[model samples]
Target: MHTIQQSASQVVRQVLAGKNLNQALSVLLSPSAGKNGLRITSQQRGALQDMSYGTLRFYGQLVRVLDQLLHKPVQDAQVRCLLLVALYQLLHTKASPHAVVDHAVRAVRKCNAAAGGLTNAVLRNFLRNRDALLTQASISEEGRYAYPQWWIDTVRNQYGVHAGEILLAGNRHPPMTLRVNSRRNSPEDYRAILARHDIESSLIKPGAVLLAEPVPVMKLPGFFEGLVSVQDAGAQYAAHLLDVKDGMRVLDACAAPGGKSTHILELAQVDLLALDKNAGRLELIGENLQRLKLHAKLQCGDASQPDGWWDGKPFQRILADVPCSASGVVRRHPDIKWLRRSEDIKGFAQQQLSILCTLWSMLDDGGMLLYATCSVFSIENQCVINEFLMRNADGRQLPIPAVHLNNGQLFPDDHHDGFFYALLQKNA
Candidate 1:
């Protein structure tokens, strides 16, 4: 347990030093020989993951509590992170408080032997004044919402009375939704297959299912056979919104891990071209296509600069799933709340507009281009689309088919993660 605490602390420390949570955790958990040469069991790995994620999820509140407990700055990043992890276990998990403190103290001694006493005192102090400290932490908006102050203001300014709900929703554990391959099975039949395995699930739509609890892909029957793929229910709307038809040329710019791209292919036998900037990520698209018995022409190239890869052929349909701050998917990735900045939004908007314009040129006359993002921010969704429409006289926005969206923006909720989709039609 102490080892797990120590490793989790290291992961958090790395993240605070500018590394994203996923990359840091992967480096620590990967099966590679290192100085420690420690072998992590599956159970230990799970514990470590929970500890790291929980610590980051409520990082603001935890920091506030720690600040109150400390007389002066600890000045040691390692010891500070260790206490943070221990506090999260005591506050959130069912772990024994005695064990948590003991393990934390032991873990701290290894990194900063002299600071072990400081660690014990701070954690014990927090336990004694848990209520007072918690109340004090909630005094600040950042602490209360567990998001950066700018992020809180941005949402409040944009969403008005509903900002609180949006911020709170991002802190909850995201639901694990699955997209059933339409060509292979129906949602009702897939629900039955899950039940036969003693797994409980609910149908979200024609091809989407929400699992009662997240399970490993190994436990998902026929997962390797590609009967279904894990995808957010909100994301399943993309393929349907693109309105692809058989024998049409479609471009999935920024396709990686190929969820939307494969869905587009599954809905219709279109001539699909999946393009991404990274060679490694493009490989992931290929792997998903292979597993599902779907075929698409995959290429590694920048979406903003398509002249290098385009064969001078125009596409009847283009899906520009541009990259952004990923504000909408924060529930699934808590690190984003801490890593993103206010200025980053404008930069993302510029990039989205650039890609939208670049991809617009690739669409045939009267073709439809679907702009999508896993972001609820209007700057990345509506603002960028509005800019494109204003700049191009021929481009006009079309209504999305989903009723839940507020002008093509789907807020994160119990059913699905936040997503924004805008369908634009070109008039020659």
Candidate 2:
């Protein structure tokens, strides 16, 4: 079996190639992992995943350290990723420095034989002058906090006084919050079940519970029975604010992995039609529905073009949880920080607007459509909301709990992902 560090380097290289963390890890760890993949035990997989996340969490700083250590870039991607993984362990994790260096040297040899001596020298140098090297790297904002300068500036400009808090929160390990399936059990009962299993949790709202520490979904009580779902507290708010009712027709545009779609179904027997652009993602929705013992009409089509998917029927309620830069949930998906570009925000805003306008046309008169994004950007949040309201005379902004009017951004905190929600009602 390949060492954990080698596996982690492979995962990191995949991420650097533009795949998200989940996708990269899945490629490495999945049983059907490709020919170039390494097969390891579950425990090793967990170790690799943790190491990869730690490296990416401080990627900017790590890259800077590499810049200082190496005279030139390592041409081989795997060898470079091995260097990153080793540095992350030596600096961030509690792993023994000697062991990390030794394993990394092995990783380099495995990745490329000629690079072994280079890896050994670089790691030894870092160990000897670690303090000086790290201190030197910390002079820049990116090195100090491990986020891009443009991203840091954007957060500061957009959030003003609270920018630091958002940036700090983005680097944290996100909490694993759960939404109780109210159809089968109350939040209190589920909490009691968790207590029985020695899992400590507290209620964030009536139906949402925040674990004191995250546990695997399989470990949670009645997880397979669908007594609860792993969802962020911020995401759980969307279903609550949607106010789904029995027999009401609802459209869940851009629904994937069906977290909100399932929550809506759990709350009430809605005639929900879940739409997503990708067929592969639609399968996730189906799996979620089957596990929850709930039903929703799943459609694979673009939310931007209703002509391809929507029938002539207007829905009483719609949840337009459109795509955005995903700045709010960076703690959960650190790859977003590196993958997203400055120009992407304006493009996302335009796409969000298109979906909103198109979906609004499919809403019944006086229907409520909850517009949402896991983004703190004003362009994607307030800008799209305001422009859509202006373009559509019938669109009226309705207030909900925790919404700030000054800027529609919801700053991230311990309790929730950075999310923005705008409840709009169509005037009959």
Candidate RMSDs in Å, in order, are 1.2, 2.1
Tens-place lDDT digits, model 2, residues 59-168: 99999998899988999988998899999988988888888888888878876999999999999999999999999999988998799899989888977888877898
The digit string of per-residue lDDT tens for model 1 on 1-428 reads 99999999998988888899999988886667486544789999899999999999999989998999998998889899999999999998999999999999999999889988988899889889999999999999988998889999999999999999999998889999999898999889999999999999998753589999999999999899999998999899899889999999999999998999999988999999999999999999999999999999999999999879999899999999999999999988888888888999999999999999999999999999999999988999999988899999988999865555678989998889999999999996
Candidate 2 structure, TM-score to reference: 0.94
The numbered model that scores best in TM-score is: 1
| Model 1: residues with Cα > 4 Å off, grouped in runs | none
Q: Candidate 2: minimum summed lDDT over ten consecutive residues — where?
A: 401-410
lDDT for model 2, please. 0.87
RMSD of 2: 2.1
Tell me each candidate's TM-score: 0.98, 0.94
